[model samples]
Target: MKEKIIEALKRIEQEFEVKICFAVEAGSRAWGTSSPDSDYDVRFIYVHKTDWYLSIDQKRDVIELPINNQLDLNGWDLRKALQLFKKSNPSLMEWLHSSIVYFQAFSLDGKMRELEDQIFQPRASLFHYLNMAKGNYRNCLQTAAINSKRYLNVIRPILACMWIERHNRFPPNEVQPLIEALIMEGEVKRELLTLIERKVTRDDHGFEVDFPIIHDFIEKEIRHLEEYANSLRGPSRDFTATLNELFRQVLEEVWSQS
Candidate 1:
């Protein structure tokens, strides 16, 4: 599967005339709770040749392939990625920290890691996760019988919010670390671990009749995180110049060798 993903990325580079600087697994696979039937969610950041960026026209900054049952491949242009990095986009941050890496070249990963502390906006990240939790809960978990995957969708974001609130940093992309750190040894932890075990071992489309303990946890955390996220302040530092310089360096590094 890794080899297949790498080949797909190589084909993307050839087809689009771009250099893939970094790529990683995302979604349930990266979060460590994928069911056996989960599809590959491959995300990457790429840069086109120097001349590609010299134009004034606003070209498309994203590349999305047709999704199949087995693979969902997509990527962001480097400029688009850096712009999101400046704004402390949670999705980009997660990509940088994802546990599964298919490819990484040049110094894009290292450079971004260096700027993570300066660029991280706790308020933005919190709200992003908070909203994810709220939306998933409202949309999927309203009834007594709930989709297990939907329950996880809500729980993971809620856990992320807890991590950010307690540590005041971007949470890890995986779910176990969040569970280990945020949840104590109790019924809640036991129930969550059981759900995750079932999710990974079996098909997640099946509905579980009841998870009152988990539901209660989710509701309380959503309310508490909403208040906490609202009370937090935004990032004070501006990283535009730094990110721009890094972007130039990457262009030089990638194209100079090309």
Candidate 2:
């Protein structure tokens, strides 16, 4: 798997004319609870030579590869990442924390890791998670009566909301860690876990539909948690200017060399 990913990275990098700083397994696989069929969510950051950005014309800031079997490789242009970093996007924050890194060069990724907390935006992140939950619930749960994968889809963001509310932080990259570290011995914890596990199993087995009780519970929980997250304004989003300076320094070093 490693060799395959490396070869794919090489092909894409050469074809795209960008340097890949790191390619990581960012989704369920990196989170330590991947099923046998989980997709390899390849997340990476890359940079182009000085000419790529020396223009008033719009630049392509993202790289999206064709979806492959059990593997999906994609990347963000470094400057694009930096601009989003300024806004404190949650997905970018999680990308920096991904557990499986397949490539690294010149300590560029290391710099991004160091600037995580300094750039995490609480209010934006909360709204990000909330909006994601709302979209997934509406789209997935609505058609879940004919399919079940959608249940797991809606559940994750709701749990993320719970994590943010309690931890007063941007939440972890992995869903399981947030659950284990944040939720303790309580009815909320047990019920939510059971729902997740059951849904996962059914999805793996290719179940046809969901139990009404389970579906209803998930809906109720999503609503309850959305309300909970909306009410809380935590100190999770404030960016430290010092950290931002550090990020700029890192970008300068990389861009200067390129």
Candidate 3:
């Protein structure tokens, strides 16, 4: 499957005439809680040759491929990625920290990691995950028999919010670390571990009997995160000049080498 994903990424680069800076597994697979039948959510960031940026005409900044049962592939243009980085888009940040790396062609991945602290705005990130937690809870988890996937959607964000509150920064993208580091030894922790075990072996449509320990934890955590996020200070620090230099460096290297 990894080989297949790499082949898919290389084909995307060839078809689009761009260079993939980095690619990683996203969604449940990356989160360490995927079912046996989960799809490969492959996301990447790519850069066009120098000439593409020189054009005055507006252009699309995203690449989307058809999704089948086996693979789901998509990517963002480098410029668009950096733009989102500036705004502390949590999804992009998650891509950066994803454990499963399919490809990395240049220094863009490392460079982005180095700038994470400087570019990440805690307040915005906190709100992003908090909203995810709140929305998923309201729409999906309120039922008596919870969609196991939707349970993850709600809990992961709640845990992420807890991480931000504790560390004053964005949490790691992986779910295992968030659970281990934050959710202590208790009924809540035990129940989640049970769910994870079931999820890993179950089919795509697995359902979990609702557990109040999980529910109560989420509600309390959400209320606390709301007040805690408000207490956080202003936006994250900026490093526009540094990012500009990185953009130039990548283009020069990738285009010249090609």
Candidate 4:
């Protein structure tokens, strides 16, 4: 499977004529709670030769391959990545911190990791997580019997909100650390652990009896995080210069050297 993923990425490079700077697992596999049949969500950041960006015409800044049952692969151009980084897009940040790395060119991934503190906006990230939790809850968990996988979708973001509130920074991408830090003791913890176990081991295709304690916790936390995030001052820093510098550096480092 790993070899197949690499072959696909190589094919993407050939087909698109861009250099892939970094790639990682983005979804349940990266979060450490994937079912046996979970698809590999491969996300990457890539760069073209300097000429690709020097044009007056705007090229598509994203590359998406057709999804297969096992591999869902896509990537953003370096310019698009920097734009999202400036906005502190939670998905981009999570990709930077993802545990599964399929490929990295030069120090692209390392450089991105180093800039996380300078570029991350806690308020924006909080709102992002809150929105995800709120949307997933509304869409999937409104009934007495809920899709079991939906519980994880709600719990993770709620925990991420708690992490940001407590630490005042971007939360870690993986769920276990957040669980360890926030849900150490109580029946809620036990239920979460059990759910995680089942979700990882079994096919996450069926609805299950909803757990009230988890649902109540999610509801209360969402309300609390809404109030807390609203009170946070907006991010004010202008990271355009920083991002531009990094972008130029990567282009020189990857393209010039090649």
Top candidate when judged by lDDT against the true structure: 1
Total clashes in model 1, counting residue pairs 3 or more apart in sequence or in different chains = 0
Lowest lDDT 10-mer window, candidate 2? 202-211
- The reply for model 1, stretches above 4 Å from the true place, is 143-145, 203-210
Instruction: Tell me the tens digit of each residue's lDDT in model 4 across 84-152.
Output: 999989999889988899987788789878988877788999999999999998876566555557788
Candidate 1 achieves a global lDDT of 0.87
Tell me which of candidates 2 and 4 scores higher on lDDT.
4
Q: Write out the backbone clash pairs for model 1.
A: none
Worst 10 residues of 4 by lDDT: 202-211
Candidate 3 Cα RMSD (Å)? 2.0
Question: Model 3 off-target regions past 4 Å?
Answer: 141-145, 203-210
- Candidate 2 residues 1-258, lDDT tens each? 889889998987789887787888877666544666778889888877657667999977888988888889889987777777767777777777777878887676677667665665566677787788778777864663534345555656666677766765666666666667765656555555555564445443555333565457567766776677567564554455755565466556666766
| Candidate 3 lDDT tens digits, 157-249 | 888888877887778877777888998867788777666767787743555544677878888989999998898887645767777888999
Residue 69 accuracy (lDDT) in model 3: 62
TM-score of candidate 1 relative to the true fold: 0.95
Pairs that collide, model 3: none
Number of colliding residue pairs in model 3: 0
Q: Which residues of candidate 4, in runs, are more than 4 Å off?
A: 143-145, 203-210
TM-score of each: 0.95, 0.79, 0.93, 0.94
User: Using TM-score as the measure, what is the rank order of every candidate, best first?
Assistant: 1, 4, 3, 2
